[model samples]
Target: MKKAKAADGKPFQGVQKLSVSLDFYGEKIDVGTLAWSKDERRAYFEYHPDFAEKRLNVSPFKLPVSEGAKAAPNSPFAGLHGMLNDSLPDGWGRLLLDRYLQKLGYDFRLLTPLDRLAYVGQVGMGALRYVPDNSLSKTDDAAIDLDWFAAQAEAVQGEVDEADVDRLLEIQGGSAGVRPKIMIGLNRKTGKFVADDGTDLPEGFDAWLVKFKSNVDPSEIGKEEYAYSLMAKAAGVDMPATKLIETKKGSYFAVQRFDRTESGSAHVQTVSGLLEADHRAPSIDYDTLLKVTRLLTRDERHVRQMFVRMVFNVLAHNRDDHAKNHAFLMAKDGVWHPTPAYDLTLSEGPGGEHNLAVDGEGKNPTKKHILKVAENASIPRAEAEQVFEQVQRAVDRWAEYAKEAGLSERRLQEIDRLLNKRGPTTAPDVDISPSP
Candidate 1:
């Protein structure tokens, strides 16, 4: 594809001016300039003149939003901040982008951020749609070979071949994560997963993302994530049902895609894209996220969901729960809600505080801090207390879930050490599960 245009009938620019519309459920909510200053130190987005709404500064980055923007920086490429960055596949997607560029006879180094956003098409997280079009298999939903995907991922990663990367992007063009992933639809009858490249399907299947873990990821990483999911559910966080896909090599962590429907289409929105925020840095605070949730959803229920997730991350010691990891989903009807949680793990983020803070407080966030936030957001004291209690219980049972998931002793101990180091004050209501 080519660059998506603004309402003024001009191609979108990167360095000078950024103008793109937010398309949700086929309606344009707002349009703004995704502009970056000459130094690239700051970026901003404002509403287009076509819309009757007031203009607001979204962010300071190139192509910060998903589809409806450009792929390369000067094009509709989604920037590498907040939500859009999370939606764009990192380690694997970057590799594929380079490969795709080489195949198109363009230098990967020369491709702009907007170029990348165009390529993301419909495969990005959340409900935002990009311009030009999304790449899907001719078949709507078909069975795919997970093992083959794994092998190809390894070949690309090991050899760093542009051809393989290009092929991979062509095969699975729209995903957001560090792992090499492909969208597949499983046949209920045949028990096979199908790769749908935006086309007709073999029948009895819809779209799903099959992720391959990198070598740096420990073997038990899948198991631990599964455990985390169970704990998150217990803590009242909305999480998609997760399963362990057992293969001869090992088990792969598989979460049902929140964006996809039974028809195999998707509706994903990251916190980054909704607020035009950045996910890579420490710019946004949890309070800002909470405020935005209320502003966008206008439902206290959604805010509560956000609160539960925050408590679960803090209590579970999953500090890697950055802005991107948390997201809101948009429906075909145009309503946005919090999507089922994924990417939960035992993580100690930058400097032992959350990648996204709790009301501007990071280290040593207390129950009092959480309650104060709840009160400010009009969350009832009883509900807020319930969230704290449930999460505390779930974190206290970590060892049981970890053991069931078969985490190695050393790895479990390492996570336990980090958990303990966070101090008892974080969750005075719960006791640390004994590590074996």
Candidate 2:
């Protein structure tokens, strides 16, 4: 069979200018235009006149609604605005795209950021859509085999020659994160899965993202993540629906796409994207997260929601809680709200410390540190304490959630011991370090 090209029938060349739009339901609203300047080696964006009149701040902090062409800071997002940068896939998705392009006799390094945005096209996580979309895919509504795709993912990671690069790229949907995953439209009633390529889905299907384990991951990572999702919800952290799809090959963790709704797609901006903060290293702290949540959503309830998530992460030992892991969703009216908590799992960040520190405490944040962060964020003491206790109680029942997830006793005990060891405590006064 002949392989598909990267951007429709067009050969993969670099993109100079791309049009941006917002896709709500099936309606497309022109947002802006992006132009790449070769001399400056950066991209400039100009908001559409109509969009500017609406004054819907797509990126309030970094790329707010403004007249004339605007250039983003160079350090964080490589000249592109943070909001647009969020649309490009990183980690696993980048790896797959690079490998696929290499097979087509193209040097991945030669492609500019605009070229990447072209590949992201309309299928990215948020409501943003790019045109002259160079994204590689064809319309084929065939049922998906998770087990087969899982094997292919493993093969690609292993750099085996027979891995189906085109198929993988078609299904990846330009998603972020390190785990090898695919975007699919699932029919719960019939237990059927189809490739979700940002197109209209068949009836009875909903968009979902499924994750397959990497070589270094534990055997039961899927079940453990499913358990964590349940635990997070129990602790009052807003979470999207999750499931553990078990196959003869292995169990894969799946979560329904919160960016997609029955009515249309919602705009999502990660803390990393909104602030241009890099997720690869420690940058912000819980206090910053809370403050941003309050500022963007203008809802104390959302601030409280962030606090609950912070408490859950600290107590559950999910240290990989980076900026990108948290996000805000925008309604059609341009109102922003905290997105449901995601990427909650057991992880040891850069140095066995939380990616986003708590009141300047990263290595060993305790109740004192949590409370200090709450105080800084202006959350009421009584309310913060209530939220902490609620998360604590849910985390205390690790064994129960683990059992429901069908985790091995040894694994369950290991996590239980870790949870107990990291349980909230009051530490002595120490010189607090500045947020990284």
Candidate 3:
């Protein structure tokens, strides 16, 4: 075991390196060796240092990086797998992880990160699979009631000691983050969401993430997220489809799980503030982000697509756009591409400026700055202009989209008021005057 400290001097102990074999699709591919830093805060990977990428504090097992857009899309550590980071219940999953180990008569707290990696088995997201399981068990595919499971998860999250909560809780720890959500399916006939526990779901409903309230947002926060998803889509951003799950209490925001379907899995990757270029830090610019996207994806089209979204985010006043909100997805063949945009919202960033500056200009990025980024990022002028025009046209219809999202007339007018104003005119000044 290796021991190290986080940047804040917090102590963490973990294995330094372990040989890992990935069952990518049907073939066996070696992800090479992985080493956890002394603090277990970062995972350093070497797939030939010349071409390797280091994914930090992501997972206990450091998976190798690849450049193929479709390659290993379903590998446990693949692109879609990152969404699992959000889908899998963090607090709930932790309780389950501990209880599962306890049930197995193992030291739950003594288990290392490697042990946690092993718990994911073959059922993990993406296409990457870790080694040596306790043998695979058929996962529960039954459609359990969502209200019931939400009640159960809420109980466990609040008090950990709930009856008949063992199996569900174990499934929770396999992912990270602090959200209390459970994977469920809606019954087409009954209009109820059921947890996927290895059984048949009643006809009509499909997979979803039923989220609960968090410390930072209100209960209707999910509704706002749903509205944001619709607005983002209407604004020409590539986004996974979203819907509002109407519970007895209120409408809950639900996003389709990119990692799973009735048949199989998709690759995922987690790009967040805790790691993956340190999203919490407000130093990364869209230029650097674009460059990284080009380096990792190597697809000029994807780069151009990303650039278009950046411009849309800026002009549309979706300021919650930060580093972690962007992700790259991988396919079974090891191909890599940008995942759909998510976690978008209208927010006044740290001090009301974008966390990621636009071509070194954050507060008042002009059209010139955006064009400069297009040129530097190898985006052709004609293509950049076309994308900009498309986004502008969609944004112009924000009222239409907002109404579609069921926003009140007052709310729609408020957002419209912000969108129509002149965008950042200077580095520090945001022009909020009503547009002509």
Instruction: Highest lDDT: give the candidate number.
Output: 2
RMSD for each of the candidates: 8.0, 5.4, 8.9
Better of 2 and 3 by TM-score: 2
lDDT of 2: 0.86
Give the better candidate number (1 or 2) by lDDT. 2
Candidate 2 wrong stretches, greater than 4 Å: 1-12, 139-141, 422-436
Give candidate 1's TM-score.
Answer: 0.73
| Candidate number achieving the greatest TM-score relative to the actual structure | 2
- For candidate 1, write residues 317-353 as lDDT tens digits: 7777666677766555446677888888766567767
Position 15, candidate 3: lDDT: 40
User: For model 3, where is the 10-residue window of minimal lDDT?
Assistant: 427-436
What candidate 1 gets wrong by more than 4 Å, as runs, is 1-89, 103-105, 122-143, 188-190, 263-266, 409-436
Q: What is the C-alpha lDDT of each candidate?
A: 0.61, 0.86, 0.57
- TM-scores for all candidates: the values are 0.73, 0.93, 0.67
Given candidate 3, what's the lDDT at residue 32?
49
Per-residue lDDT for 235 in model 1? 80
lDDT of 2 by residue, 194-231 (tens): 88978888899999999987766777888988999999
